[model samples]
Structure formats: structure tokens, C-alpha cells
Target chain A: MLDSLLQFLITGVTVGSTYALVGLGFAIIYNASDVVNFAQGEFVMIGAMVAISLLGAGTPFPLALLLAVMATVAVGLVLEALAVEPARGAPVVTLVIITIGASILLRGVALLVWGKDFHAMPHFSGDAPLHLGSATLLPQNLWVMGGTAALVLAVRQFFRRTSAGKALLACSCNRTAAQLMGINVRRMMLLAYGLSAALGAVAGLLVAPITFTSYDSGVMLGLKGFSAAILGGMGNPMGAVAGGLLLGVLESLSAGLISSGYKDAIAFVVVLLVLFLRPSGLFGKGAVERA
Target chain B: MHMRKRFFGLILGAGVLAAGSSFAADPIRIGTFLTVTGPASFLGDPELRTLQMYVEELNARGGVLGRKLELVHYDTVGQAKEAVTFVKRLIQNDKVDVIVGGSSTGDTMAAIPEVEKAGIPLISLAGGVEIVEPVKKWVFKTPHTDRMAAIRIFEDMKKRGIRKFALISGDGGYDKSGRKQVLELAPSHGLEVVADESYGNKDTDMTTQLTKIRATDAQAILNFGFGAAPAIVTRNVRQLGITLPVYQSHGVGSKKFIEMAGEAAEGVRLPAAALVVAEQLADSDPQKKVLLDYKAKFQAKHGEVSTFGGHAYDGFFIAVEAIQRAGGTDPARVRDEIEKTRGFVGTAGVFHMSPQDHMGLSVDAFKMVEVRKGNWVIID
Candidate 1:
């Protein structure tokens, strides 16, 4: 029983780490602009797909990875410039809807380019499993969990330490006040989107080996990440990470202990319970008036 | 006045003769509705291609029953409601004599009532036993049902002397039906299911379920699912280092599954239509010639010849043969001829239709194939 529990935890943490990375992207964008970027998942898909296509074309793995990340970042910036920026000062709900539209458009383009076949990426360091007591872990699982932790820490430091990150936080807190203080709010928004896109791409690249990717692979991942962000505390990057891991672990345990069929249901029920009890989320602060 | 009436009668007689001549030379219309451009496009796109290619080929060879074939098709985009609407249009607007389409079970089931009402024969390409079992009078499917696949896998297990196994399935319609069939048929085969687990359609990881299965004393594992999930399950089963034999349903028969699963798919067994291993079949095998001929013709035009296209091939040829045997496009006669299909060599199997069996295929239609070095090799 203990061994099975360990196995479940291992699987959960690995799965959750991907969700954490995606959730982090959601949290960052939500903080910078009060719009939930529904297209965040598409960023994950684009990252992996671009890398796969590049690798298929005989490019080396490392170069393909770098180019794919760069391409995804460019797409993020483009999305903000064309879709988000043009609708600046629009209602948050409308902006969210625009992101949803952008996601559909991105998915459509991906389908046209890649067709409707699932593509596999060779494991980063081979597919040999690492044994831990009675449990086994893939080298790719380590990449996902470690990569997510490092990205989370880096994002936290960016918000807390860097001047540009601080400026972005200022914009999130109050755009007019930040502008008054000579902060280029638009540039900060662009940076936030770029950083978020980069995070999403890295998650995709890490998880692609474990889960084969197609054009619309990101839809489910994106939703899970969104849930993780909401569960952790919508705008808190660190909370989003925690929420993602927590959600993954919960799903794994429930699936292991109760039933695999009810895994998603059980996890989402917990999220719903959390929301009902604490509307601001597990780590979110209370709502404050700004007038 | 009498002379004017005679002139009118002469004109009427000329009009009747012209209509009668045109009727003899009129093309026989075969209506199709497939999920051509959606998520399930993988199944429908090839099916539509096969129908078009064969219709063209048949017409080139002087057509079926001395009349050219006209294929009137619509893209359902994997929608059941669209399938119903398209079937109605085919029956009412196009006034087609026969229908041979419906790429998925949902679409096929939805279109059944309309075809039955219109008294037109429909040969569906979908893989649900419900489409034929309990037998709809106007409906017949060409592909082997999920139930037959389950029975085939179980029979192989029983023959190998394996009594206990675990089943991991996806929650989709196809997978759920397959899982249900396996469980329902296990006891009759003198087999016991030690563990049964399921995963969501879009789940990326299935290690937890596999881990749970590992704790069980199951002698082997059978995965019943379609799409990328089965590959993931296969990878996870290997990753956990559980060396028990793995079996998959026919849903993963295509080479794409092997490509996605990579080396992990080696030694994994599944029951698939003979079309998948066409080149590997012995010379004496009856389906070898038909399979090779269809594969070559299809590959010449469109790249790969999936079993989906093969289903369409069987469906089209069966309909065409029935029309020829009927000696006309009479709806009732054509339906009876399709039911009377016996010893008909096609891509799927040697179909033998009876009043009780609309699909006209048994478990023998599936050849037990194993993934050997990333290619399918027939084991039985």
C-alpha cells in the first residue's frame, strides 16, 4: 500500500508540475492584465509542435528547443499586440473573450499546419525508468518537476526583486498610478505576456515526451492550469504553483484510492469546495477597495 | 376537335418515350455522409477518398449494372445531427438508391431512423455492434464491431492459457463499449478480470492507474481505448517496469499508434482487420489479393491506406455487388441482396450475411497481430 501511494505521488507530482507551469502563465497574465488568457494553452501546444517540426527537419535538439521557445514568445507578443493591445481599456470580460477567440484562431492555424496526427518527441535523456523503492520514475518526469520548480522560483524573484518586474506589479496593482510614476505600462504588459509564453513553452517542451502532442493537446492542459491558478489564488504565482501540485496530487491519490473514473471529478469537486469556502483561493488575499 | 386531340396524344406519347430512355441511361446515385473535416476526420477523410476512387474505377470499367455511379457526399464534421440532416437530404433531395457512410457510431445511429423510414439501404462504416446487432432492417455496417474485437482478444487469451487479466480503458464511446464487451464476455470465456481501470479521453498520464494495476496479481493487461491515450498507457506500463504481457484493442491497429508509442509497442498484441497486415498474409489466404489490390490502388492516389478506407472499400464493393446481383437499383431487392452476401471476399473479411446477422462477420474477421520491431506481424 505504501509503495502504491509513493507511485501515485510520483505520478501526481510529475503531472502537477506541468499544470503548475501552465498555471503560472495564467497567474502572471492575470496579474499584469485582469484578463484570463484562454490562449495560454495554445502557447504550450505551439512550443512543442514547433520543436517537433524543427526536429523533424533535421535540426539539433537543443537548437530546436531554443527556436521553439523563441517562436512561442514571439507568438505571445503578437497575440498581445494584435488581439490584446488593440482592445486596451476594454472590459476584462471582453478581453477574456478575445483571448478565447485568439485561442481558437491559433488552434485552427496549428491544425492547418500540422494536420490531425499526433506526433511524439523522443525523451530528452532516454526513456529508462529510475527506481525509488518500489516506485519508478522517468527521466522526463524529473525534467518536468525540476523545470517547474526552477521556473516558479525565477518568476517569484522576477516579481519581488527586478525593477521591471516591480513595474509590472505596479501596473497590475494600479495602471494609472504606475503610468504616473513614469513606468511604461504597455511595455510591462508586453513583458508579462512574453514571460508567460516562455513559461508555457518550457512546460510543453518538458511534457511533450511523456504525453504525445497534437495541435489541440493544450486545451485540456490549459484548463487544468487555469483550475490550478484559481485553486492556488488567481493572481498569486507561487499559489498557482502550489495549487497545481496540490491538484495533481489530489487527482492521483483519488484515482489510486477511490476510482480512476472519478479522478477528475474528485479533483474538481475539491476545487469547487475551496472556491466556495475561500473565494479568493487558498493563498489569495482578501478583496480590497481602491477608490 | 378530334384532330387536335390526336395531336395532343402524340405529344404525350413522345414525352413518355423520351423519359423512359433517359431513365435507362440515368446514373445510380450512392449518397455518403462522413466526418470529413473535423476531429474524426482521420476516419472520414479516407472513407470519402476510397468511395470516390472506387466509384471512378467502377465507372471506368463500365459501371455496376450497366449504369454509371454518382457519389453524393456531405461532410458531417463528426456531428450526429448533421448526419441525420445529410441522410434526409440524400434520401429526399438527391433521391439516392443506396447509402454507404457514417464514419462514427453516433452518426450512424442517428441516421438509422431516417434510412429505415425512407426504405433505403445504408451500409455504415462505423464500429458499433448496436448499429447491426438487434439488427435494423435498412442498416448494415462493414467494419468489425468492438464486441467482436473483445471476443477475439479473449479467445487468444484463453488459447494461451491465461485466465486472469487487467483492463484499462478510455471513457470515450468506443473505449467504453469495448471495455463493456470485454467484461461482459470474460466469464463466458472462462476468464476473470482482476482489475478494471479507465482514464479520460484527453488525459496525458495514466501511470497512477497502471501502478494500481501493477499491485494486482493480474497475469496480463489489456488496454481498450482509441487515439493517443492507448500509446500513453503502453508507455506507462513499460515505464513502471511491469513486464506482464500487454494487449490492446483494434482501435490502435494503425501504424500511427506504433510510431507514437515507439519501442514500447513491441510485443504488444491486438486484433486488427486483415487489411493492416496485407503484405504479410500468405499466398493461399483469400483476402491477400483483394487487400493488396485495394492497398495499391489507394496508395497510388492518397498516401496511406488506413483500415478506415478499407471499411469504405468493403462497404462500397458490397453495395455495388448487391446492386449487380439485384440486376437493378430496386431498394427492396438491393437490401435483400446485401443480406444475402455470402463468401464475398473483401478487405475486412469474407463476409457472409444472413437474416439474423447484418454485419455478417465473426471474431475470425480479426487477425491477431503483434507489434514486432515497430511493424505489425500477424501472429494468428
Candidate 2:
């Protein structure tokens, strides 16, 4: 029984780290533009597919991974320049729809380019499992967890220690004031998009070896990441991590204990209940009156 | 001798005229709806290509039964709704004499009621037993059933004295049928299903499910998912370092599964049609000649021979034989003739259709195969 519990927890954490990465992608973009970019998950697919194909073609793993991240960063910039920038100042709902459209288009293009087969990559480290008493954890899980931590720390450092990052935060707070302060708000938004895409790409490349990657896999990843973001209070990076981990643990526990069939439903039901009790989410700030 | 030569030439001229006039009549129309362009395209594309190749060959030989064979095909894109719409279009608009399609069990089931109402002979490529069980008069399908596949796995496991088993399947129609079969058939085979878990079809990670299975004292694991899920499960099981014998269904029989699974697929076993391991089939096996011919022809034309495509080959031959036996392209006659088909050998297996059994395949039709050095080798 203890072994089972430990096993589920390990699996949950492994999957949670992946969700955290995606949640961060969502959180970062939400902070800058307040447009829920539904195409966030495709960044993950792009990263994994590009890296895997390059690896298949005999490219060094490190170079292939670097190229994959760069490619996704390019995609992120292109998405902003073409889709988001054209309809600047549009209603949040319309921008959201544009992102959704972008996601569908990206998914279709991926299906055509990558074909419909699921691809598996060899683990970056080895496949050896570290025995943790009753539960054994894969090496890839460590990569995901470490990568998530590093990204979170880096984002935190960027906001607190960098002038550009402070300007981005200022723009998120008040675009007019930031522009008056001589900050380039548009460039900050572009940077946010690029950073978010890189995070998603890292997540995808890290998780692909364990979970597998395919063209349509991003839809579920995006939804789960969105749920994690919402649960973590939307735009809060720390909240995204917490919500992602909590959701993953809850899902795994339910699947392990109650029923695997209703695992997804169970997680959503909990999230729904949590939202009902606290409308702004677990970590979200309740309505604050600005004087 | 001169008189005999003149008589032969006259007879040949008369034969040519008869053929030419017959060709002038309305052609026999056969419509197909398959998942030729979506995630399940792996199944549908080859099936469509094989059907097209066969139709072209038949047309080259003056078509089937004195009428030119006309094929109207649709890409269902793996959607059940698309399948139904195309089935309706095939019957109502195209006015096709017969329908051959439904690459997936879900699509086939969705199209069943419509085809039954139209009373057209519908030859399905999916392997779900429900498509034919409780036997709809107009519905016939090729390929072995999921129940037969499950039973085959159980029988093989029983022989090896491995009674306790773990079952992990995808929550799809085909896998659902497989799960049902294993649960229902386990008792008869004197086996216990120690653990039964399921994952979503598009689920990337199943280590959680595998972890649950690992807790069980199962002597072996049976994975009943289709597409990449089975391969994912295999990888998870191996990554978790569980060394118990793992078995998969015919769903993972193709080389694509092995490719996706890579090193993890090395020793995994599965129950699949002989078409998968045709090269390893014994020369004396009854299906060797037909299977070899299909593999050669399909490879020659399409550069690869997918086992799923064999379902279409069997379906086409069954329809043609029925048309020939009925002596016309009338739907009712063809439907009746198809019901009486027996010992009709094609790519998947020798089909024996009857009024009671629309899918004429039996458990014996499946071959036990295992992955060895990234290639499928016949085990039984």
C-alpha cells in the first residue's frame, strides 16, 4: 500500500513538472498581454518534433535541443508579430480566439509536416531508475523537475534583477505609465512571448522521451496547462508551479486509488470545487478595490 | 484447316463485340469511406491504396462480371460523423451498388444503422465483432475480431502457466471490446485478471497506470491499446524496470509500433494476423500464397505493405466474389450472395461468411508474433 502511494506520487510529480512548464508558458504570456494564448502547447510539440527529427538525422543532442528551442522562439515571435500585433488593443476575447485559431493552424501544419505517427526519443540521461524506497523514479523525471526549477528561478531573477524585466512588469501593471517612463512595451511583450515559447519548448523536449510526442498531443497538454495556470491563479508564476504540481498529484492519486477511468474528471471536479469556494483560484488575489 | 481458321476468327470477333456492348452499360459502382488522412491514416491510406490498385487491375481485365468497376472513395479523417455522412452520401447520392469502408471500429459502428436501413451490402474493414454480431443482414466485415485476439492471448498465456495478468487498454471502442473480451474470457480460461487499467488514446504518459499494474502480482501484462499507446505502455513498463512478460494486441502488430517503441519493443509479444509476419510464415501454411502475393503486389505499388491494408483487400475480394456469384450488380442479390460466402481466402485470413456470422474470421486466424531485433517474428 505504501509502495502504491509512493508510486502514484512519483508519477504525479513527474507529470506535474511538465504541466508546470506549460503553466509557466501560460502565466508568462498572461502577465505581459493578458491574452490567453491557446497555442502555448504547440510550442512544446514544435520543440520535441524538431529535436527528435534532428537527432534522427545524426545531429548532436545538445545542438538539436538548442536548435529546437531557437525554432520555437522564432515561432513565438512570428505568432506575436502576425497574430497578436495586428489586432493590438482588441478585446481579450477576440485575441483569445485568434490564439485558438493559431493553435488549430499550427496543429494542422504539424500533422502535415510530421505526419501522424507518435515519436519516441531516447532519454537525455540514461533510463536507469533511482530507487526511492518503494517507488522507482525515471531519470527523465529529474530532468523535468530540475528544468522547471531552473526556469522558475531564472524568471524570478529576471523580474527582480534586470531593467528590461522591470519595464515588462511595469507595462503589465500600466501600459500608458510604462510608455511615459520611456519603456518599449511592445518589445517587452515580444520578449515575454519568446521566453514563454522557450519554456514550452524545453518542457516538450524534456517530456517527449517519457510521454511521447505527436501532432495532436498539444491540445491536451494546452488544456491541462491552462487548468494548472487557472488553478495557480492565472498570471502568478509561483502559483502556476503550485497549481501544476497539485493538479498532477491529485490526478495521479485519484487514478491510483479511486478509478483510472474517472481520473481526469476527478481532477477537474476538484478544481471546479476549489474555484467555487474561491472564485479567483487557490492562489489568486480576491477582488482588490483600487482607490 | 482454312475453314477452321476462319471459324475461330469469326468467334473471336463475336466475343469482342459482346464485351464492347456490355461495357456500354452502367458500371458497377462501389463506394468507400476510410480514415485516409488523419491520425488513423496509417490504417486507411494503405487500405484505400490497395483497393484502388485492385480496382484498377480489375478494370484492366474488363472489370468484374461484365460491368466496369467504378470506385468512389471518401476520406473520413478518422471521424465517426464523417463516416456516417459519407456512408449516407454513398448510398443516397452516389447510388452505389455496394459499400466497402469503415477503417476504424468506431466509424464502422456509426455507419452500421444507415447501411442497414439502405439494405446495401456493406463490407467493413474494422475488426469489431459488434459490427456483425446480432448479425445485420446487409453488414459484413473483414479482419479478425477483438474477442478472438483477446482469447488468443489468454490461451497463449495459459499454455505458458502464467495465470495472473495485468490488463492495460486505451479507452477506445476497439480496446473497450478487447477489455471486455479479456474479462469475459478469463474465467473460462482459468485465469485471473489481477489488474485492469485504461488510459486515454492520446495520453502521452501511462506510467501511473503501469505503476498500479506493477503493484499487482501479475505474472504477465497484456496491453490492449491501439496506435502509440501500446508502445508507450511498453516503454513505461521497461523504464520502470518491470521484467514480466508483456503482451500486446493486434493493434500494435505493425512495424510502426516497433519503430515507435524502439529498444523497448525487443521482446514484446502480440497476437496479430499472418500478414504482419508474412515473410516468416511457413511455406505450407494455407495463407502463405495469398499473403505473399498481397505483400509483393502492395510493396511493388506503394513501397510498403501495412497489415491494416489487408482488411481492405479481403473486403474487396469478398465483394467481387459476391457480385460474380449473384450474376449482377443488384444490391439485394449481392447482399444475399455475400451471406453465403465460405472458404474465401484473402490477405488477412480465409473468410467463411454465413447468415449468422457477418465476420467469418475465427481465433485460428490470428498468429502469435513477437518483436525480435526490431522485426516481427512468428512465434506460433
Candidate 3:
């Protein structure tokens, strides 16, 4: 019984870590642009597909990893320039719709480029499971948990210590004041897009070996990521991480203890109940006022 | 100016008349709505290609019933609403003599009411038994039903002296239907289901479920899901260090499943059509030649042969044979002829359609196969 408990915890943490990465991607983009980029999930997909092809073509794992992240960053830049930037000054709803459109377009393009097949990558270390007392965990799971932590810490450090990150935060806080202070608000949006894409790509690469990759894999991941972001209070990075991990644990425990058929329903019900009790989410600021 | 106008009008009239006369020998129209662009594209793309290839070959050999065969296809994208719209167009606007497609059970079930009202023959490529059960009269499917897959796996397990096992399934129509059958039919097969669990369609992890199954006294595990979920389950089972035998459904007949599951797929058993191990079948087997030919032709064009496409191949030939036997493009006649089809060997299996069995496939259609060194090998 203890072994099963340990196993569920491990699975929850591993899956939750990936969800946190995706939620962080959502938080970063929402912070700068005030528009949720639905195409954020496609970045994860692009990273996985690009890395797989590069690995197939004989590129070293490290080089292929770098190239995959760079490729998704470039895609994010193109999406901003072609889709989002063109519609500058649009209403939030319009921008949201455009992001949704971009998401569909990216899915179609990925299908054309990669075709409709599932693919897997070799584990960075090996397939052997690490023995936990009375339980086992794949090495890939550790990679997922470790990589998510590293990315989350790196993002936190960038926001806290770096000037460029501060400028982006300023844009999120107040566009007019940030512009008056000589910050390029538009540049911040582009940076946010790039950073979010890179973060999502990292998430993809970290989890691709375990979940495998397919052209349409992004759809569900994107929905869950968006849900995590909303559950975490919409635009708070720390909240996103906490929300993601919590959701993952809840899902795992429900499947293990309750009915597997009701696992998803239970997660959604809990989220709804939490939101009903706490309208601004667990960590969301309560109705901030501005001048 | 008046003379020139008259001359141009005359030329246009003559052109129209010539076109009308030629079109009076109108070709037999075959329309299909397939999941060619979305999550189920792995099934629909190949199904579409097989139909296209077979139709082109037929036209090259002087067309069906001496009228040119006109094939119209639309991508349903694996959405039920998209399937409804496209299937309506196929029947009402395209005026196709016969229709084929619906790559997933969801798509197929969604289009059933529309097809039944239209009264046109529909040869479905999906594998849900609900698509044909209770004799819908106009709907026929080519793939072995989910119930057949369950019975085949249970029989294999029973033969190996296993009576109690666990079942892990995805929450899809195919998986649900199979789960229902397994639950209902276990007692008949002298088997007991020790543990049963289900996962969401998009779930990426199954370790928790596997852990629970591990604690059970089930002798083996049989998974009933389509697409990559099964692969994830296979991987999770191995990751949890469970050594009991793992069995899968025909939904995962492609090599991609093995590739995704990596070393975990080794020793996994599945009940699938003979197409997966086509090259290993004896010459005396009836399906061997048909399977080899379809595989060769498909691989020559698309560079791969998936069993999902083979389901379409069977559907196409079944429709064509019916058309030829009916001797015309009339929908009613075609439907009648299709119901009369029997002993027709195709890629999926030797189909024997009837008024009672629109699916036409029996449990024998599924061969027990085991993954050996990353390749599918016939076990018995």
C-alpha cells in the first residue's frame, strides 16, 4: 500500500512538472501582451517534432535540443510579426481570437510538415527504472521534474535580477508608464513570446520521451496548460506552477483511489469548487486598481 | 456585329450540346468522408490513399460497369460535426452511388443517422461494433469489431491457462465498447476480470493505474484503447517493473505503437488482422496473397503500409464487388448486393456480410501476434 502511494506521488509530480512548464508559458505571454496565446501548445509540439527529425538526421542530442528550442523561438517571432503584431491595438477579445486562429494554423502546418504519426525519442540516459523503496520511477521522469525546476528557477531569476525581464514586467504592469520611461513595450511583447516559446519547447523535450510526440498532441496539452493558468490566477507564474502540480496530484490520486473514469471529472469539479470559494484564485491579487 | 454575335452563340450552343451528350454516359460516383487531417489522420490518410489507388487502378482497366469511376472525397478531420456535414454533402449534393469512410468510431456513429435517413450504402472504416449491431441495413464496416478483438484476446488468454486478468482501457467509444463486451463475455469464456481501469484519451501517464493493477492478483493485463494511449500504458507497465504479460487490441495494429513504446513493446501480445505479420503467413492461407498484394501496392506508393489503411482496402473492394454484382449504380441494388457478399478475401479478412451481420468479420479474423524484437510475429 505504501509502495502504491509512493508510485502515485511520483507520477503526479512528474506530470505536474510538465504542466507547470506549460502554465509558465501561458503566464509569461499573458503578462506582456494581455492576450493568451493559444498557440503556446504548438511550441511544445514543434520542439518535439523538430528535435525528433534532427535526431533522426544524425544530430547530437545536445545540438538537436538547442536547435529545436531555437526553431520554436523563430516560430514565435514569426507568429507575432505576421499574426499578432499586424493586429496591434486590437481589443483583448480580438487578440484572443487571433491567437486561437494562429493555434489552428500552426496545427495544420505541423501536420503537413511532420505527417500524422506518433514518435518517441530515446531517453537521455537509458530505459532503466530507478528503484525507490517499494516503487520504481523511470529516469525520464526525473529529467522531467529536474528540467521543470531548472526552467522555473531560471524564469524567476530573469524576472528578479535582469533589466530586460524588469522591462517586460513593467510593460505588463503599465504600458503607458513603461513607454514614458523609455521601455519599448512592443519589444517586451516579442520577448515574452520568445521566452514563452522557449519554455514550452523545453517542456516538450523533457516529456517527449515519456508521452511520445504527435502533430495533434498540442491540443490537449494546450487546454490543460490554459486550465492550469486560469486555476493559478491567470497571470501569476508561481501560481501557475502551484496550480499545475496540484492539478496533477489530484488527478493521480483520484484515479488511484476513486474511479479512473471519474478522474478528469473530479479534477474539474475541484477546480470549479475552489474558484467558487476563491473568486480571484488561490494567489490572484484581488481586483487591483490603477490610476 | 449581328452576324458575329449569331456565330458566337451558335458555337457556344454546339459546345454545350457536345458536353451534355458526353456526360449522359455519367460515371459511377463514389464519395468518401474520412478523418484525413486531424488526430485520426493516421487512420484516414491511408484509408483515403487506398481508395484513391484502387479507384485509379479500376479506371485504368476500363472503369466500373463501363462508366468512368468518379471519386469525391472530403476530409472530416475526425470531428463528428464535420463528418455529419460532409456525409450530408456526399449523399445530397455529390449524389454518389455508394459512400465509404468515417475513420474513428465517433465519426462513424455521428454519421449513422444521416446515412440511415439518406438510405445510401455506407461502408465504414471504423471498428466499433455499435456501428453495425442491430442491423442498420445501410451501414457496413470493414474492420473487425471491438467485441471480436476482446473475444480473441480472451480466447488466447484462456488457451494459456489464464483465467483472471486486468483490463486497462482508454475512455473512447472503441475502448468503452470493448470494455463492455469483455465484462459481459468474461463468464462465458471462463475468465474473470480481476482489475479494471480507464484513462483519459489525452492522458500522458498511466503509472498510477499500473501500480493498482500491479497490486492485484491478475495474471496478465489486456489494454483496450486506440492510438498512443496504449503505447503509454505499455511503457508505464514496464516502468513500474510489472512482469505479467501485456495484451493489446487490434486498434494498435501498426508498427508505430511498437516504435513509440520502444523496448516495452517486446513480448506484448495483441489480437490483430494478419496484415501485421503478412510476410510470415503460409502460402496456403487465404488472406496471405491478398494481404501481400495490398501491402506491396500501398508501400510502393506511400512508403508504408498500416493496417488502418487495409481496412479501407477491404471496404473499397467490398463496395466494388457489390456494384459489379448489382450491375448498376442504383443505391438500393448496391445495398442488396453488399448484403449478399460472402467469402470475399481482402486485406482485413475474408468478409462475409449478411442482413444479420453488417460488420461481416468474425473472431477468426484476428490472429494472435506477439511482439518479438520490435517486429510482430504470429504466435499461433
DockQ: which candidate is best? 3
Model 1 scores a TM of 0.95
lDDT of 2 by residue, B140-239 (tens): 9998888888888888898889989999888887788889988998989999999989888877678788888888899999999888788888888887
Between prediction 2 and prediction 3, the one with superior TM-score is 2
Could you tell me the lDDT of residue B252 within candidate 2? 80
Q: Per-residue lDDT for A73-99 in model 3, tens only?
A: 999998888899989988989999998
Tens-place lDDT digits, model 3, residues B70-173: 77888877788888988898889879899888898888899899889989999999977788877897999998877888888988898989989999999987
The lDDT per prediction is 0.91, 0.86, 0.87
TM-score of chain A for each candidate? 0.99, 0.97, 0.98
User: Which parts of model 1 are misplaced by more than 4 Å?
Assistant: B1-24
lDDT of 1 by residue, A1-291 (tens): 999999999999999998999999999999998789999999999999999999999999999999999999999999999999999989999999999999999999999999888989989999999999999999999999989989988988998999999999998899999999999989988998999999999999999999999999989999999999999999999999999999999999999999999999999999999999999999999665554
Q: What is the per-residue lDDT of model 2 for residues A147-246, given as tens digits with 9 covering 90 to 100?
A: 9999999998998899988887887777788899999888998998999999999999999988788898898889999999999888788888889999
For each candidate, the DockQ is 0.78, 0.50, 0.81
Please give the ranking of all candidate structures by TM-score, highest first, separated by commas.
1, 2, 3
Ordered by DockQ, highest first, the candidates read 3, 1, 2
What share of the reference contacts survives in each candidate?
0.89, 0.67, 0.93
lDDT of 1: 0.91
